[model samples]
Target chain A: MDLSPIWLTLKLAAITTSLLFIVGLPIAWWLSKGRSFFKTIVEAIITMPLVLPPSVLGFYLLLAFSPQHGLGKLLQDTFDTQFVFSFKGLVLASFIYSMPFMTGPIKSALQQLPVSLTQASYALGKTQWQTFKSVLVPNIKPSLLTAIVLTFAHTLGEFGVVLMIGGNIPGVTRVASIAVYDSVERMDYAAANTYSLILFSITFVMVISVFVFNKYQAKSPLE
Target chain B: MIDLSIEKRLKAYRGQQILKISHQFTTGSITKIYGPSGAGKTTLLKTIAGLVYPEKGKIVVDSQTWLDTDNNINLPPQKRMPGFVFQDYALFPNMSVLAHLQYATNDMEWIKRLLLLGKLDTLTDHKPIHLSGGQQQRLAVLRALAIKPKLILMDEPFSALDPDMKTELIAELKLLFKELAATVLIVSHNPQELEGLTDGDLYIP
Candidate 1:
């Protein structure tokens, strides 16, 4: 089995996880603080990808980014780029697919915070961003870390969205899951075993590490 | 100088009617609002500080109108410079007591003096959630004092303490408030704690 697909999956998860932190943190903050009747509706929309079938999302994305479409045309005209059937397209799909995994922990964590914390920061003459950085975010470090780890892990296991839009191109769009599927389809059990075993061990280690490390940290006096 | 007459209805569970009352909190003086629980005491403080908006009323602080119904002016909470402390002692849990003091001002000597005055020297690196109830209350008072605002609003400031702790904090707060001469509005439901702790009158529900 080619390890390139495994490497690409890791790269995609890392980049998407990093970018989602920047986008999702403020949104989670706003939802945590702002009051509105439409809060549920807005929240539903962000987490829509969680319930929406990945095939449907991939179908829509393929249409929107097919180079002949409007968004594709605009991107091509402006940046001389095409997105359909590419690694970037897979990454974008995974980002959308895994957004709720990031937002869920963050929103719940932030919602549990006391208003007095923000009030104290405001009373101390700190700006909203300053307060978020110095007070709110730091206090919610465990949640933020959860968001990162969950999003990355979920993105790593992504299959349907990557398969539909990625077209299973070798090394470029052939992520580990897709490669496993390809090996299975071609009756190559050995290759499939190699890729599947690695994916399983990596995922197992990640999840176990999260639980073990959290337990260790909890037991340590430094925590 | 802060002048505010706030009124807002907060419908709590079991039909308890909590309202921000229309009463003048005198400017440039320590005017206490003494009320029982669910009497809208905390709401009044929040409304005066612009943390909560009154459905209809006005708040004039230092000659600058913060919230007025007829004039249609309601400033946000951040723009209003009021040092407020809640019942739970609203110190940032992520910050040390020293950082909390530093967030308010940068005068190290003044901070050290304030720390010594409040006897918070040993608790400098402690977070709010980790501190004892009395220590947290003292920290809250010091945090407000550090801001040096024109006015301060405290909701049941000394409620979470033993008698001795309460007496000590009240004494320290009185000295500091008298020294700075900053206007203060403290809510108190504890009548016994109010007798010697407050130098001002009460607004009972």
Candidate 2:
């Protein structure tokens, strides 16, 4: 059985999880502050992926970045990048598909923190950025780890979105999930079973690690 | 001298109650703020520390305009640094006792002094989660003073301490506050808790 698909899947999951972490942190922090009409709308849009069908998101993403018209045309004309059937397209799709997993836990943990933690930091002459980096982020380590692992595992399991946007290109767009589907269609049961078993084990380990870490984190009086 | 006049709308158990106060604090003086429950005692401390925004107010601290709502000049909490010992301690669970003071200031000697004052020198490596209630309270007070702030706002700093420990700590803090020339505003339900330490008193009715 070919192993390129497994490597590609790992690469995609790593990149997607890292990018989402950098981008999702500030968004989650902003959303946790309080509720406004604008924040509600933004959160709704971000959370839509969890409820919306993957096929629908994939279809829209393909059309929007088809390199034929609209945003796709704009990108094609300026940066000369195609995001429809490339590895880049898969990353973009994974971003939209797995975003809620990354932000949900983080946002809730941030909201759960006592307001006095922030006030105490500010009272010590620390700026808002300092307070967030030193006080807020450190306190939410367990939740952050959970978010990262869940996002990684979710990206690894993505099939419908990848199938729609990233077609079966041997070394480029064909991830482990897509490879498993391809093997079944060609009557390659052995290869399909191998891919399925690998994904199952990896995801199992990641999820179990999250539960263990959370349980081990010491409980605080303030929490 | 700190001159403060502020009005804020508070959500009380009964309904809406307006917290109105106009007072001046002499430099290096310790003032005890006593009031009944839901009298906005904590709110008043937060407002002075710039943690809470008053609807209409002016806070002039030692000739510095900390807040002037009419003039639209309000310094952020970072700009108006004040040592605040929260009622709940608000200690960082992830940081050790030493780390808390180090975060507030780079003065190693000051940190050592504060550790001794709070009698937490041996537990410098312990996190808040590992400390007892009284130990956590002392850490909170020590962390606040780590910055050696000109203004100190404490909300029941000795609530968890035993009577003997409370008395001893208060006496040490009184001398330290005088040495640092820090103005202190303490809120407590029990007036006798701070009996002789405070030179002035502000009663909110």
> Which candidate gets the maximum DockQ versus the true structure?
2
Which residue pairs come into collision in candidate 1? none
- Scanning candidate 2 chain B in windows of ten residues, the lowest lDDT window is B187-196
- lDDT minimum window of 10 residues, candidate 2 chain A: A214-223
Q: Which ten residues in a row have the lowest lDDT in candidate 1 chain B?
A: B18-27
Q: Candidate 2 — which residues are off by over 4 angstroms?
A: A218-223
DockQ of 2: 0.90
Model 2 residue pairs with clashes: none
lDDT of each: 0.80, 0.94
Task: Provide fnat values for all models in the order shown.
Answer: 0.68, 0.95
User: Judged by DockQ cut-offs, is candidate 1 incorrect, acceptable, medium or high?
Assistant: medium
Model 1 ranges with Cα > 4 A deviation? A37-39, A216-223, B14-20
Q: Candidate 2 residues B11-90, lDDT tens each?
A: 99988999999999999999999989999999999999998999999999999999999999999999888999999999
